[model samples]
Each structure stands twice: as C-alpha cells, then as structure tokens.
Target: MLSLSFLCVIAFFAGLVDAAVGGGGLIQIPGLFSALPNVAPATVFGTNKLASAVGTLSAARSYLRRVRLPWRLVLPTTVAAFVFSFVGAQVVSLIPKGVIRPTVLVLLVIMAAYTLWKKDFGKLHKPVEIGRREMAIGLAIGCAIGFYDGLFGPGTGSFLMFLFIRFFAFDFLHASAAAKVVNLTTNVAALLSFAIGGHVLLAYALPMAAANMAGAMVGTRLAMKKGAGFVRVLFLLLTSVLICKLGWDLLQG
Candidate 1:
C-alpha cells in the first residue's frame, strides 16, 4: 500500500491540475486505485468525491472572486446538475460502462479535433444572449453531463468546458471557472450519496482535502495570471489525455 504522504502528494498535484483545467481525476483516481486495490469501489469513489469536492470548491471560490459569472445561466445549470447527478447515481448499475466508454471516446475525439481546427475557439469570452433558449441549453448540458458523471465517471470536466465554450460562448478561462462550479455540484451530490451509504473513508479524505485545497489556491492564481490562451492550451492537452485514456480502455475491453 502507498503511504498516506504519497497519496497526499498525489492529491496536491491533482488539485493543482484540476483547478486549472478540470482533469484532476486523471491523477487522483488512478492513484487511489493503485493505493487501495483491495478496497471496495464504492469507498474509493466516495473518498475521491470528498477530496475532489473540497478542492473544486476552493478553485470555484477563487474563480468567482476574479470572474464575473452570469448567474442567470449558471444558476439553472448548477441546479439541474445537482438534481440529475443524484438520479444518475441511482441508475448507475443499470447502464453498462462498456457502452458509455466508447461513446465518450468518440465525443472526445470530435471535441479535440474541432478545438484544434478552430484557431480562436475559446480565446474570447463572448457570451450568448441570456434568453430562455440559452437557459434551457444550459440546463440540458447540465442534465446530460451530470448524469454521465454519475453513471460513467470520466471526462465530466472536459465535457463541461467544451460545452460552455461551444454553446455559451465563454472563453477558456470563463468556461473553466464555470465548469468548476457545476463540477462541484455534481461531486457534492455523489459524495452525499456515498457518505450516507458509509462508503467514504474520512481518515484519508480529510488530509487529502486539505492538500487539494492548497493546490487549488495556487492553480487558480496561476490560471488567472496566465490568461485564457494558456488555459486553452492546457484544456487541449488534458482533452488529448482523456482521449488516449478512454481509447486505451476501449481497446483493452
């Protein structure tokens, strides 16, 4: 088993990367699996959610301080995500992960290719008009991705970032900031379920949460100072990693 110190270090970097562009699970989840191979999947997932939720909140708070979010849109999206995430978690067993994995792989590929093709895709923050249609769109994005997060549990952040940029016309920075808020909501929903089911390991979760929070602070500051262009680059890199990860999983399956 890996030492707690080693896991804390992994959590730190996961927080840092997640706070910047929302791929922290790529690091933390694998570390958890490696460190706790004998543990039940529920406990592992629950612990991850607890640690990640705290880190995501830290990043969201920092982003909210500097970025002016459109609450008109953000509110509905967050609400939908929180509600539907629970629904998704309840139905997780009914859906086969085998089906979800390949679909996500294709979507990631298309998303990555489109972002690469569009030179200025997320460079500028030009929000669409806040009409009923836009609000509905936000809710739809929230519902779909939130459900996916609950059921399948990969690439939620990347998916949210891309949707925000593509539909809401947010730049990379704003999209990331917004994605943090929605992601936090979903995490909290899942964590609550796990906690109630007695799946969370508080012994590990608390320390990792603290480390993740510290990392989030540094990451948000770096992202704000560096600007949207830098975030766009990181987004692409993370998405590329997601693509490779899912593709490999599919091949193995």
Candidate 2:
C-alpha cells in the first residue's frame, strides 16, 4: 500500500511537470525502479508508459481544446513519430545505452546553453507557412526523435518542445502544447507493445493513471494562465535536471 501510494504521488508530480515542460520520466522512472526493485525492468518500464500515456493524453487533450495548433504539421509529425518510434523499439538492442546516454547528455548541455544564450528564444510566436519545406522538416524531426525515444527514452518531450520552438517559431506555450500530442503518441505506441508483451501491471498503472490525469489538468490550467515565459523557464529547469541526471548515470556507469 505504501509503495503504491508513493508511486501515485510520483505520478502526480510527473504529470504536473510533464504537462508543463515535458520530462515526467525523470520523476516516474526512477521512482518505479526504487519502489519495485524486485520487479523485472521491462514491467517497470511498461507500467511507467501506461501511467505516462494517460497523463500525456490528458495534457494533449487539454492543449488541443485551448491552443490552436497547425494540424497540417501535427498530422504528419504524429504519424511519423508513431511509426519511427515503433521501428526504434524493434532495434533497441542493436544500440547500447552507454553510447546513447553520453550523446544525449552532450545534446542536452548544448540545447540548454543555446537556450540560455538566446534571451529571446521561444519568446515570440512566428509560425511558418505550411509548405513542402516545413512538412519535410517536420517529418525528419519526427523520425529522428521518435527513434531516439524508442531506443533510449529520455528527454523526448523536451527535445520535441525545443525543435518546435526552434524550427516552427512557436512560443514556449504552443511548443509545449504541441509536444504533448507527439509525446502522447509515442507513449501510446510504446504502451501497446508493453501490453502485448505482458509487461504492464494494470493494478499500479490504473491508479497512477488517475493521479496523473488529475495532475495534468492542474498543470495545463497553470500553463494556460501563466503563458509562454513561464513555460520557457520550466523548459530550461527541466532540461537542466535531465542533463544532470544523465550526467550522473553516465558517471556511475
């Protein structure tokens, strides 16, 4: 009961953070490992996905209802993300965690530094016209990041948020909102695989999913009220934490 309670609390915070700036796995993944040390890693990961998918879907729905996204871009991006994420999962064993972690850590540091350096980054919304060029760019980003999410599975949301802001000229708020949709798609794809593999633990996932949805609602409200600058700050903070966490893991390994 205590362990379940702890996981529920973690899921709530994870949803809150994820709904704001994307990095819920930073919170929930470690919590699962610590709480269920005796469980198989695949099961823990699957349960995490189940709970996270619900929270992300909740956040995505909230954003979709309130924010006006470019569906022209969103559709292709989502399809590409779902397909590539599954492909990445199929070949996950071909790559090694050691190789991926350090590379991701470096990318996070670079992304963080660039964001810090550009004071006006993600501050304004200047969406590009939907054209062949933009569509191609969106597809490329979806393929790369989707594969990364399936293969290594950290900072997927942050990466998507950054790319949306940097490439699409979306403000932090819009970027975060759009990222939720893509993130939710990836989570659902991964969750289906886990469910098929019998790795998901519904007893824990259902409760955590409920807590996560509630947190996502609260978080979406906060972001909508606070606006883009607030989300930019959150993006930086969460990315920094991810950087530090990945750094620590690499060092330990």
Candidate 3:
C-alpha cells in the first residue's frame, strides 16, 4: 500500500512533465521498477503505458480545443502509427535493442544540441512548407517512431515532437500538440497488446489515470497560454534529459 502510494505520487509528477513536454517515462518507468522490483519488466511497462495513455488522451483533447492541428497530416500519420505500432509490439522480442540504443542516443544529443544552438528555432509559427511532400514525411516519421515506441518504449514523444518541427515546419507549440495525437495512437496500440497479455496492474493504474488527467489539463492550459517559446524550452530540456538517461543506460550496459 505504501509503495502504491509512492507510485501514484510519481505518476502525478510524471504526468505533469509529460503533459508540459513529453518525457513522462523518465519519471514513471524508474519509479515502477524501484517500487515493484519483483514485477516483470513487461508488466511494469504495461502499467506505465496504461497510466500514460490516459494522460496523453487528456492532453490531446485539450490541445485540440485550443490548437489548430494539422489534421490532414496528423490523421494519416496517426493511422500509420497505430498499425505499425501493433506490428512492432508483436515483433519486440525478436529484435535486439542493443544496436538501437547508441543510434537513438546520438540522435537525441543532436536534437538537443541543435535546439539549444538555434535560439529562435521554435519561437514563432513559421510553417513555410506543407502538402503531399510534408505529409509523406510525416507518415514516414510516424511509422519509424511508432515502431520504436512499441519495440523499445522510451523517448517516443520527444522524437515525435522533433520530427513534427523538423519535417512539418511547425512551431514547438503546434508540434507538441500534434505529437500527443501520434503518441496516443502508439500508446493505445501498445496498451492493447499488454492488456491482452495480462501485464498491466489495474489497481494502481486507475488512480494514476485520474491524477494524470488532472495534470494533463493543467499542463495543456499552461502551454496554450505561454505559446511556442515555453514549449520550445521544455522540449529542449526534455531531449537533453533523454540523451543523458539513454547515455547512462548504454554506459551501464
């Protein structure tokens, strides 16, 4: 019971961070492992997804209300992500994640460094590019990141945000909003697999979901109010943290 309480607290803050930017796993996953050491990794992952899905769903709705999302791109990309994520989840056991870690860490480092160096990168909305070419890029990014989400399950949201900004030429605020939709699609796909496999801890997930929803609402409101500048800073910070976390994991292994 005490441990469950701790997990809830962790979920609350994780939801806040995730809603503000997109690195909830950094907080939620480690807490789950520390709190329930005996639980299988798959179960812990499943429970974390369950909690995060609720949070992302809430955030998505909030963004939809305030932000004008590129549905033409988001809708198709989300569909691709949904299908590919299921495939990725099914084949997760066959893949060796060792090779992917270094590549992912390098990419994250580049993303963080580039964002930091470019002071006015996402400060304003300047989507000078759009149409079929952009849609194609969005689909490709969604497929690639969705596969990563299902197979490895870390830094998915940050990757989505980065891709949206880079490929679609969206500002940070709009990119983050779109990323939530894609992230939610991937999360739902992963969650279904986990739930079917009986890996989720429902007892903890329910309360965590409630807390996550609250946090998402608050975070989305703040992002909408503060605009792209705030989101850009948060996104860079989250990417830096992800780089460090992945770098540490690679070193430890």
TM-score winner, 1 or 3: 1
Query: Tell me, what's the RMSD of every candidate?
Result: 1.0, 0.8, 1.2
Residue lDDT tens for model 3, 173-216: 88889989999999999999999999999998888888788878
Residue 148 C-alpha lDDT in model 3: 87
lDDT of each: 0.92, 0.91, 0.87
TM-score, prediction 1? 0.98
- Tens digit of lDDT per residue, candidate 2, span 79-101? 89998888887788899888899
Listed in order, each prediction's TM-score against the native is 0.98, 0.98, 0.96
> Which candidate has the top score in lDDT?
1
Model 1: per-residue Cα lDDT over 33-88, one tens digit each: 88888989999999999999999999999999999999999989999999889888
Residue 19, model 1, lDDT: 97
Candidate 3 lDDT trough over 10 residues, lowest sum: 121-130
lDDT for residue 249 in candidate 3, whole number 0-100:
89
Separate clash counts for every candidate = 0, 0, 0
Root-mean-square deviation of Cα positions for candidate 3 versus the true structure, in angstroms = 1.2
Off by over 4 Å in 3: none
